[model samples]
Target: MRQYLILLLLFTLVQSAVTDSPRRPNSNPPKGFVTTKGSKFVLDGKPFYFVGTNSYWVPLLTTKEDVESTFKQMKNAGVKVLRTWGFNAINGSELAAARNSDLTYYQVWNSTEWVLNDGPQGLQRLDNVIAMAGKYNIKIILTFTNNWVGYGGSELYVNWIGGAGSTHDVFYTHPKIIASYQRYVKTIVNRYKTSPNIFAWELMNEARCLGDLPGGPSCIPGSGTLYHWYNQQANFVRSLDPYHLITTGGEGHFYWKKPVGFWYNGQFISDYNFNGQAGEDFDRDLTLENIDFGTYHIYPQYWYPQLDTPGSNFTLKAWGIDWIKLHAKAAKRVGKPVILEEFGVTGLENKTDIYPAWVDSALSTGHGIMPWQFGALGLTENGGNRVIKYADALINGASPNDGHAFYENQTTVWNVFTNAAKVQDAKSK
Candidate 1:
């Protein structure tokens, strides 16, 4: 009788442990989107598959009316997610224009420190975004910062804490900079901790240790350091809001071995050779327990500049397909869901063909994809990578002067988007 009682007690403890694991289903009623049973995402007790769009500029660029109209348009088109910017650190030069500049999102406190301005200038737009998201039944993945300087990213933080001309790695190591980031995370997480509209909190936007220029290559931090910083930041966010999911908005480019055979697994400082390959290791980063899912962004034209003709070595579409397959395989190895958070076509390429082919490959990954942006295809940025215009823009002849211009193949890509959403939704059902 005594032996049997001990056995029963052990069994109860084991079962409780299993149930208490973060990935395990909770006894409480399902509320928001969550990672369950490993790589699968569940919302309201059902599998959650999404067709999302990138509109990073929405919080800063669009007004309340424009935002409502935008979400209305997306809901009608069947888009389930909107990934937008959550942070906008003002550059020192941009402060003078903060009172009147349409782009400045924060007010400078002492020519160094910054704070969210009042009214429509700062995070009020984000508040409206969240409210609108709930109204439209759309989820939002809010990214903390950008890796580049275009929108006053890490440089802004580094400049404030470490002064200008500081290296990219300092943003991750500087004490003040890290604290500032933590403050931002805490502020936003606490603000929306109860809102079901938030799908996840992304650590940064395409975070790479790069040069001042948006796409220019620079010193890549050691893979271990990069992931460690990500882990720290992600864990901090989780501590603040344990209910929400977390992700690192890495570019998904793995760092390669330098000098032919270095056996570095990103554990020590030496693994990061400053003179060596500098980029994010998608597979390794996603392996962290703190990271709820994997994220990847591709610009085939930017990565593989050697675009081919009809039957050459490698076409842009083939490259895009290959990237998705490789990263999907990585995600499978890591047992995590991989999201193609951002991809776009160059203005010179025919998006009609590229978008469909990439979507098919993305769906094969058993997750989902979000193209570079939604809204309009405006003045090209970063070596021709442009947003895909809305279907209505193409059909209605919305020109650049009216805010955006439609590409010749924009309608075809939009069709791919709507059709893909329908098929994915059916599968989820």
Candidate 2:
């Protein structure tokens, strides 16, 4: 069985089942709009940098009337950009409403995350987020998926959303599943192809469709469906929009260095067939240009001191530097600049937060870095009140302007990130 090769047609049918929202206005790149590689973003030929905690409060800073006020806060702090999350809770009551509905499965069980809802389920709320980002001159690295991968459970449901996976996602070799992916991607990209503020496409969040095992899977549609799945995805992003750049959210360690036959390289060479590329001398870039850019993730406690958080002091930022060098080298090897998409240090671990310094070293070396998060995760109000409390100081106090201080538990990483906010004056320009 050749297994569904009518790619373009199969994509069409899949969209009918998952289709929700009607088309909206989109922002296309202007004529001759070439995104040049610079220290920061180059919108229409200028320098830029997206710096800020993955801000949760910034989006809701001030009253509803001043939604853009958060971006201003970043600007005020001399921060140029904020790595904003997709779904955010507007009304706490909605959380209850979603739980009562059949929507929980669609949202990775995180009702507070608004991005998971498709169609009218969360259209208005999402629009406000996009509008707020635009109003503040903030460019977004909008991720379609969440950190649902490693958490397990219902994530399998999300993974199987369209055909074993969509056009690029070859989760399983299932017939209809692969077809469904093709359609799902076409629908989503066609709807948003022209959004100027949508900096790029992040197909999913930290996904590992293929298990971490040797001789597991590869680029070909075979034992390892993850590679084929990713190819379908990466290709879909390019075909539908053909404007904005795109990359996998973060497939974890494999994103950077994979085994000789790993899927990242295997999909093109065949993961199960490492020697398959030996005929071509295993040229690394065969599928390198298949994607627009490169992305990677890191777990410090796992890689560095191996000490559980608050106790470990793994300071290599090893992947960060290697990512820049490897991907940039790889990008140049294939003609693209690398993007350091996701990396996070647990704020819940041992009171010390080394992430800020970690990030500083990476970006100072001049790689595009999007730290894990902001808002309730790192710098949100504590002890539950309208008041905003940033984990800037271990002491836990109110922000300026008399905002109250509330905290869950203060980690050293929190204060370092808060302090680093001042160091990122580069974004303002």
Candidate 3:
């Protein structure tokens, strides 16, 4: 009897240890879901060097036909993956004042609490997008929220919980705010956790210490705060959905211990992007055990005007290429895949001149690339080709002529992506 009691105690201790052990990578991801395999994305036991595009308004459109048309155009262009907005937060007053009664929204803040919209004008819109994507054989990376104010983002949450004078960064640490965000996350993740078409779940779109509104007095300017928030949120997502991949939808800013300076035209800026001012440290963020891959964006025309000039020795093209190489190197160091998730240049001629070289760089470095947007061509009243736009991107009938969108009519620019997709597909096989 004494010997048996000792043996049972030992067995109980061993089981407890196993229960407390850290989670291992999902060795057997479900079929048709994307997973990482040592510095590359693998889908169904094959390398997935996907060339995709962003279409944030796909879920916000009022008509299912428009959604199908968008997916059809993307499929024809050889796009295998797409990154889009999976969040739409609004207050009741805003919804009431909307011009269209059929406006789509996912969550609504009703003065004191959040009411999730799972009806036809809410998450059902997203359901349509996922259904169409699966039908078209494309995967989706769904971003949970935005850092900007264009679509009720972090600021909206701040306003909701912290009230009138709250800072944007409070969305990261405040317990109430975090709980609310996670409630929405849990609802969405649980609803579609079994979907094979979900490529990944992004924590936020371009998460930063500051947003369109001010940071106020309580914001921290380093990587620690956001890092903590990322670990918390990412682990939560992983806990709920172990099969799908996860990523931080960041702009890939660095807060290096030994920061590197680069020459931008004639100026040597030491600490613009590399500094921790934005509270983003790409290297540090990627190191979190739950984070499966890394992502970075390139918008030299907007972020670094000095490099955007043509005829310069170090033009935007050169800088953008180097950026791709840098992130690829980091991905290798961390033993994970890194994607040049977004890149774009203004003007059709500039895009024609610059994007091919950037695409080639991403391919050479074994990194995936998605441009800022992909636009579809629609017929005007006179039967002329006009670009279909939605949400805040609507200007006349065209998408935000932010000059970054690659519309179907711009064949030269469109071909750059289609050809890259073909090359990527060939490499994957």
Best of the candidates, lDDT: 3
The prediction achieving the highest TM-score against the true structure is 3
Give the candidate order by descending lDDT.
Answer: 3, 1, 2
Per-residue lDDT tens digits for candidate 1, residues 210-288, read 6473322234434466776787787677666667778998878765555322222343333221223445767678887
Model 3 Cα RMSD, 1 decimal: 6.0
| Global lDDT scores for all candidate models | 0.68, 0.43, 0.81
Give lDDT tens digits, candidate 3, residues 239-321.
77878888999999888767666676477677657877788888899988778999999887788666546666668888888
Pairs with backbone N, CA or C atoms under 3 Å apart (clashes), candidate 1: none
| Backbone collision tally, model 2 | 34
Candidate 1, which segments miss by more than 4 Å at Cα?
1-30, 107-109, 213-223, 256-276, 307-312, 376-409
- Report the lDDT tens digits of candidate 2 across residue range 215-328: 223433223344444555566566566567666555333322244432222353323222331111112322433445555555544444432335333243543455445444
